[model samples]
Each structure stands twice: as C-alpha cells, then as structure tokens.
Target: VGDALKDRFDGASRVMSNSDHETSVQRNDAAPHRIPRKDRYRFQLRPHNPDHKSPGVKDLVYLEPSPGFCEKNPRLGIPGTHGRTCNDTSIGVDGCDLMCCGRGYRTENMLVVERCN
Candidate 1:
C-alpha cells in the first residue's frame, strides 16, 4: 500500500491535467468529501509487505557511491581536519581523541598580546 501510494504521488504531476484539477476543485468546493468508515477500517487492516529486494526501493533508501569524507580532497572541497584544535578534556565530538580519528594530537603553548580601549 505504501509503495502504491508512493508510485501514485510520483506520477501524479505528469498525469494530472488542468481539467482534472478544475474538477477536483469544484468537487472540494461543493462538499468536503469524507472517507467512508468501512474504507478507513479496511485501509487500517491492510498488511504492509515491504519490497526489500527491489532495485528501485533499494536505490531510493540507501546511500550508494557517497563521497570520501575523511581525506583532504581539494577537488571535492573536503578540507579535512588534519590540524584542527579540539578540547582534550571533553568526551564528546569536539574532543581530540574523536576529532583526530584515533591518530592522536599534539599540544603547544603560545603567548598573545591584547589591547583594549
């Protein structure tokens, strides 16, 4: 039922005509049509059998042929975090351990001069 609905929605734009839209609008304006109770109950009782093996379904859901995220590929605009500063104490995404991708990190101290008016 889900796949059928998806196919119908996908093809609606190509198949729908101006006359069809006008008719639908007219019907809507006349009386807001409500689904029959029996039909609603039947829809609810319908079993969902997903098409796991279908190539179309697989291509729609899975991320295939994705770009390489880690390496510094200038052409792909992926300026990898080779020397990015990360917090050493926090056990989060910003932490040195995770940011460095288990490659480890180095620490250095520097002096800065600031002026305020």
Candidate 2:
C-alpha cells in the first residue's frame, strides 16, 4: 500500500513540473488582470481484496473547514489571550504589543507570602 501511494505521488510531481513549465510560458503573454487557472487532482484507493467492507478514504473527509485560532471563540473552545501573561519589555510574540492585540495592558503588583522551615 505504501509503495503504491509513493509511486502515485512521484507521478503527480512529474505532472506538476510539466504543468508549471507550461504555466510559466503562458504567463509571459497573459494579461495582468487575468487570473491563472489552478490545477486539481483526485485520488482513489483500490484494496487488494474486493470483498472487504471497510470504509475508504472518503470517510475521513470533513463537511466544513476548521475555524482558525486568531481570536477568542468560546463556541469553538478557543480561549484567545485576553488576560494571559505577557512581557512588556520584549518585542516578540509573547510581548505586550502583539499579545494584547493593540489593547493596552495594565500592570499589577502582588506580594507573595512563603513559609520555609
């Protein structure tokens, strides 16, 4: 099964290379306002035993695409960083500027009580 899938992928790569070359040549004479057509391919799986009643690859297909995690979505269980800790001094993604999403942060100071014997 693995070998058959690998062979199919290799063949698809060759076809893609040829189509890419043809598209590049066509782009030279194509209008700036025109959009290029995208290439689409479909694959079907054929089991060794036809009598088997197992589900095919189509069973893994989803009806709708997933909603990404850019903002807070309670329905999707994505708790976007509203009160999450962030670094005010740093400039990375964990920094206050990016993490707060332009909403300014307030600084809070807390005293810790520890007992050590």
Candidate 3:
C-alpha cells in the first residue's frame, strides 16, 4: 500500500487530490521555492508476521528507524502501524514512543477482543 500511495504521486490518478503539492524546493538567495522535478516517495515497511520472534506491536513498536525492517516483501499493506493499538504505560516496544514512528499517532476508541475465561 505504501508503494501504491507513492505511485499515485507519479501518476495522474484522482485517488488523492490533495497530494498536488511540492515535494521539494530550490534555493534562491537563501530563499527556497518549489521546483518541478522527478519525484520518488521513499517508504519503509514493517510487517507483523508469524514465525518472527516478535509478531505483535507490543514487541516491535519501540523502534526509531526500526534498525531491521523489511522494505520489501510486505505481507500486509503499508498503512503500516497507524491502526495498531498500544499500551499506555508500555516502557518498551509497544508504546506510542515507537508505534508512532516519529510521525506521531492519533487515537480512537473502538471494540477489541478479550479472552473469555
């Protein structure tokens, strides 16, 4: 999905009309201004797959650049961790600190499954 979102910038698709903004700018006497150029949207992917030592956000959400991420071979879309839940007091990986990926994150109340014991 990250690739698809990026590709939308390189094509004339109506999926995102608000994306028609300058990707970069040039400098002129210390001032910068928009300059048209071939654009490429750099993206990274982190997947939550089974068999991996840590498959849940609680274990993988505390990384800055995610030292060991799979930019390729994504089993899930790149909406990425935006929709994943987090623990309020997560001192480790699964907190807002890492789950937001520095881009920050927003929250919403929703239904979740719990073990019925």
lDDT to native, each model: 0.55, 0.58, 0.47
Give the alpha carbon lDDT tens digit for every residue of 1-117 in model 1.
899777755533211111232233334656876656654333111112243332332223322345665568999899877878898888988888887887889977779989998
Which portions of model 2 show Cα errors greater than 4 Å? 1-70, 74-77
- What order do you get sorting by TM-score, best first? 1, 2, 3
**For residues 74-94, could you state the per-residue lDDT of candidate 3 as single tens digits?**
554434566678765686689
Better of 1 and 3 by TM-score: 1
Best-matching candidate per TM-score: 1
Report the Cα lDDT for candidate 3. Answer: 0.47
Candidate 1 global TM-score: 0.38
Worst 10 residues of 3 by lDDT: 12-21
**Candidate 3 pairs with clashing backbones:** none
RMSD of 1: 13.6
Stretches of candidate 3 off by over 4 Å are 1-79, 109-117
